[model samples]
Target: MSHKGCCYDNAVSESFFSSLKRELLIDTSQHSAQQAKTAIFEYIEIFYNKQRRHSTINYCIPELFDSSFS
Candidate 1:
């Protein structure tokens, strides 16, 4: 689908990466690509996509997200 006018298309992806970098990359102990990848995977799968709630999701987590529309 064309996302030319859809902020929703890019918004969550950006927010997720920002949170991951802020929480993982800025940590002085994370010094390697492997460490960064592990941290990001954990953050995305465990935190962002599962436990952490989002205001945009009407405070629901990803498992509760609707797929009927964008």
Candidate 2:
């Protein structure tokens, strides 16, 4: 296993958390860890992954992207 304190070992994870905190966490002020978990889960599952539009996905939201692929 890699050393515990290596900063380079976590670059991707840090980037992901930075993006998440910048994009999602800043929009919310959750009081509890459980609430934050649930809110993040819903935002990713119900909104971002399922309904949010991505330019990389050809301007269609995820839900429509799947249908168009069929």
lDDT of 2 by residue, 1-70 (tens): 7998786899866765675777789999999999999988987778777776776788788888898869
**C-alpha local distance difference test of each model:** 0.75, 0.80
Regions of candidate 2 where Cα sits further than 4 Å from its true position = 1-19
In candidate 2, list every pair of residues with a backbone clash. Answer: none
User: RMSD to native for every prediction?
Assistant: 6.1, 3.6
Q: Where does candidate 1 have its weakest 10-residue lDDT segment?
A: 61-70
TM-score of each: 0.57, 0.66
- The TM-score that candidate 2 achieves is 0.66
- Count residue pairs with overlapping backbones in model 2: 0
- In model 1, the runs with Cα more than 4 Å from the true position are 1-9, 64-70
Q: Best candidate, TM-score-wise?
A: 2
User: Cα miss at 17, model 2 (Å)?
Assistant: 4.7
Worst 10 residues of 2 by lDDT: 12-21
